[model samples]
Target: MSGLKRLLKKGLGLGDMAFSAGGGAINWFPGHMAAATRAIRNRLKLSDLVLEVRDARIPLSSANSDLQPLLSAKRRVVALNKKDLANPNIMHKWSGYFERCKQDCIAINAHSKGSVKKLLELVEFKLKEVICREPTLLVMVVGVPNVGKSALINSIHQIAQSQFPVQEKMKRAAVGPLPGVTQDISGFKIAQKPSIYVLDTPGVLVPSISDIETGLKLALAGSVKDSVVGEERIAQYLLAVLDTRGTPLHWKHLNNRRAEGVEYDVEENHIYNLKNLKPKRRNNPSNRCDLVYVEDLVMEVQWALHSTLTEFNGNVEDESDLESLIDLQFGALQKALKIPHKASEARLMVSKKFLTLFRTGKLGPFILDDVPDHTPVS
Candidate 1:
């Protein structure tokens, strides 16, 4: 653990500072999760195969450690969801890491049939022998909250309906952008020939996370609620990560090659809302901006981060210095995102909108988890 911490500090800059300094105090484990864990374990005994879904951006952190022992013992496939929102170059390295651990891993975008089809094929291949002999088979899909388990099940239901028509009216699994949308385990009949059922379980996490960094990753990746972790802290962590990896520095050259050809209209005068609406947890589709609007905003944010890091003279290893840099960034981001100077909650507004852009993949693709060198495989 010490070695991993040193490597992460050297590479990504999550140093010795505790996340509690961010001023968020909330329960990590709710009562609902306590019951969900026991239910999932009981169902695992009846499941013939398990689709262990994880956030592609935080692949390792998203795994439910409490259930990993039983999950890995059964026939399982680690399905990394929301791959479209993850860094394409780093995903293969993660896949290789899983392969070394002897796990069948696939990066998938639940909304894409093309990607989901490949996963279904893999599941069939794994259960080829049982398909012929068993009269019934249960396929359970489980994950931490907001990892897109519901979306995947809905897609699978559509595919099944196409393959085998049903006379009774069927309902799709409830899908939402927030965590813990599905409260109970619901089974969908995918096939009638052999009575294959797909179980969609409520997202569950262990009572306590192993580390502060893991909790932060889960919060950033949407496995945990922003209110619990506090949006400001998550945004601070995001800035720290971008700063440590020199991500913003690389963005400078990305558009510098086109610096001579492109220009923005000064008279456009388009003001997009950077409202800090606490009521709405998800990015509203109705308020979505045009491509030109979003592109310009992203450019502003990248330049803001790049300029701040480029001008500062401080030690990245010192947690105090990093926190001071983060404070400066909140001011810079408020200006970049065009939030009103006099806004009462300017910092909170900047944090929420900034997080939305990253979560929606508007700023750029990112993978928060670094591949481990070695670990015990269950």
Candidate 2:
């Protein structure tokens, strides 16, 4: 545990010169992204308010470093989306960090109507001055890839349509799990009195990433395409972060708490059959027991990780030792996750599934980005 900060700096860097997709940068700034960036810059001139949506897991890393300067000058509210998938305990600290920087910020889940309403409340408050003079108000929503910009817009649209009378037929934004889903910037009229329009832009990344670790953080958070960074590499990075922080070991305490509750319940005559809870029909893949299997799978994966980290005698601070431990845990996870022993793409499959769990938050809530040592005064 000596110099934990130094250890993470070296170990998580993983000896990569740069994060590469195809022996090059994960530079996925498509032609549309370039055109849209220009358009967004032009439109920013007229916008009254800007909602900068960011992935809650990687608040700092998911930001477009190239556009931060421009965004900082504008009237902007930082909406950290996907809060449900992040560590709620630390969310207030992040919010406070933004507050100290004098930026208007809110952590939100785009899917929830209540959450989006809170954001809208803030947006309306920000635009109170513009609401009086401007015949029409423009609120631009911008963010990097896969950070739920479209999803947030859709929720906002639904809320606005019902609350405000609009002449145009309401059309929903194109929301997808992958990046580059929004090819063109489209506007939705959310209110009629002042004619507030919310513009949804294509998710864009910088021409070049600021650093490889930032790139990996983006990839792990699904801002960058998985193919660009490779699933195995991202999963390894995830494992490394988990190990170095001793995150899985904490799961032991959580499980122990649950075990105590279960034992107490058993004593209180609440009969429970642990063995029978396993999915009965494995052949029928779509069986309802699949949910049970998923729960079991998560438990197994957690146990495997906890066991490996606890038993393995090695310095997790050392890159080689950490790599060795990650490899061992990969094998342990493959078995725990029940990947086919002889499958040609077993490792890849394991990586994909493992990443899925982490992304979907079955693994657990996480906040990948750490708070900066000094909060810049804006």
lDDT of 1 by residue, 213-267 (tens): 7877888888788887678778877887787777888888755624667765543
User: What's the CA error at residue 298 for candidate 1, in Å?
Assistant: 0.6
lDDT of 2 by residue, 1-378 (tens): 532334335534434535433323556678988999999899999888899999999989989988899899999999999999999999999998898899999999999999999999999999998888999999999999999999999899888878875556667888776788998989878888888899999999998774656777888998888887688888988898898889998988646634655422112222223233332445755433445456656777898899999998999887778878989999999998777799999889889888888887888899999998798765
Per-candidate TM vs. native?
0.88, 0.87
Among all windows of 10 consecutive residues in model 1, the one with the lowest summed lDDT is 17-26
Enumerate residue pairs that collide in model 1. none
Kindly give the stretch of ten consecutive residues in candidate 2 with the minimal lDDT sum.
263-272
lDDT of each: 0.80, 0.82
lDDT value, residue 65 of candidate 2: 84
Displacement of residue 70 (Cα, Å) in model 1 is: 0.8
Instruction: Please estimate how well model 2 matches the true structure, expressed as its whole-model Cα lDDT.
Output: 0.82
C-alpha lDDT (0 to 100) for residue 158 of candidate 1: 84
Off by over 4 Å in 1: 1-26, 261-271, 274-289, 375-377
